[model samples]
Target chain A: MKIPTLHIPDGFISAPVSLLFLVISGFFVFLALRGAKKQLDEKVAPLAGLAAVFIFAMQMINFPVAAGTSGHLIGGALAAILIGPWAGVLAVTVVLIVQALVFADGGLTAIGLNVFIMSVLATLGAWYLFRFFQKIFPKNRIGFLTATAIASYLSVPISALGFTFQFALGGTAAITLDKVLIAMVGVHSVIGIGEAIITVLTISAVLSVRKDLVFGASKLKVSLVR
Target chain B: MSTKRIVQIGLVLSLFVAAFVSFYASANPDGLEFVAEQVGFLDTAKDSATGSSPLADYGLTGFEDERLSVGIAGIIGVLLTAVISFGLFTLIKKR
Candidate 1:
């Protein structure tokens, strides 16, 4: 069960609503670039590129979460795990923009909202929660997996609320906010399992290969941050 | 990682993706489709207004060879995504 994309139905978004979200997402991308520049060491750059390409490749192969539901990698946690939060948001936003413009997988007008909810909100929110969980769990694979799992689960409906509020604010559908929220959150809870497993396994594998590369993976040398 | 290592990783990952998509994807309706059906607006999802596109519905276009048509579409999608992603990254990195 793929965490359903916050793809607003066509005709459901007005020009101004769409424009506002586009601007918000654009501003965040700018912020992320600035953040990356501050955080960038020579090593993080190439790894981020490798990581982005990896995320792009993996997204094409969604796994079945249930009988009819298939879930794909949002890769937000993985992104945050490797890069810092702001950089992670930017990475996912870039992917979404490419998907919108070239693939037509998600709509153009709805693109802004999609990126905002799916990329910015999910990645940043997941990053914060991941850190919180990391503090409590054991400082090893279990810590990483537990944090990734909870963060992945929380992110879906946090992004879901982002979508719901948008719909409540600008929806064309006669559907109520309660109905929308319930449906979005409920379905996403199921989809989140696939995301959690993927995030955990990916983080575990990468950390084993190069713990130096995973920014969110707990404990490393003092001089590495620069 | 070495350049050769990076190439190897990319190749293996892409192959894994191709295999998975061609086989493991769920045949049933997704959440959106389910919601639409439940809400009785499923009919609204007919052809797009800009309906002249060559590839739609992931190319299950009533072709005689179901597997070939779908497999082709899936492969095309992966190629398009990779090319677009690589191009976007290259341009952004240049700046």
Candidate 2:
């Protein structure tokens, strides 16, 4: 089998839709930069760099999820939980840009589409979901991993939905919408499990040694009565 | 652990994964590409503009050994990602 191009390539979506997403993605990157400025102080800066490198490295490994299908960590959820949503977006954006420009893993024209889904949609969505779950779970290691697993799992399907939405708007092919939805969501659901496992494992690893580095863990409030 | 230690460990782990462990990754089409194929839209996919890059598809062009090609490319990607992201975060920290 040929080495899989891990991201959306050109011609999957129409030119107009791609350009539209370019503008949208660009705007989000700008917002991320502004927001990241507040969180990316001197101490957190190197951690952010390590997080991006780890993400890029992990994306290289595609584990087989099912027959004829493989999956890799998106790492958006992992980054968001490790750092924060804003900086997470920038990290993933950097990965996407590098992959596109250097490795050609993603298409040039489709860079915006990839960024919107992986960087904006997955990172922010996972962060918010994690925050919600954090309220329900205990403020401990198990609780943190549970929340990370749940949020990261859902984040993958959410990203799949992003692609489905774009394809519906401007797919170059004439595939049926329902089929596209079913196949995309079905495969991604399995892929999401891989994402969840990796995210949880990585989070737990860091939490074991340096829990202070995890942005999500830092937000956990300890009860005075407990 | 000190911040420097954490970065050091993380870097080592990342390099190991990208350079060695990644060589064993599954070669099957990923979820997105699988969906496109099963849904009859795979043909709509076109070559990326950088399809001919030396590092396109995560393998070094002109290298006969697939393992070495991919391994080297993975290392390059990790380093590039580290530099760009670190520079970006430093700039953000300053601003």
Worst 10 residues of 2 chain B by lDDT: B86-95
Candidate 1 per-residue lDDT, tens place, A1-226, comes to 1223323444554557867888998888888777766664554555555555566556655566554555566777778777677667766776665555544455677778878887788888899998888877776666667887899878876776787677677766576667767776776677777778877787776666666667885333212221
Best by TM-score: 2
What TM-score does each prediction get for chain A alone?
Answer: 0.89, 0.96
What lDDT tens digits, residue by residue, belong to model 2 across residues B42-88? Answer: 89889999988999999988888888988899899999999999988
**RMSD, every candidate, angstroms:** 4.3, 1.8
Pairs in clash, predicted candidate 1: A1-A65, A1-A69, A2-A70, A2-A71
List, in order, the clash count of every candidate structure: 4, 0
Which CAPRI quality tier does the interface of model 2 achieve?
A: high
Candidate 1, residues B2-94, lDDT tens digits: the string is 533643575557545643454455544544445444544444333333223343444434555655555555555555655654444444442
TM-score of the B chain in each candidate versus the native B chain: 0.68, 0.96
Candidate 2's C-alpha runs over 4 A off are A222-226
As a whole number from 0 to 100, the lDDT of residue A103 in candidate 2 is 93
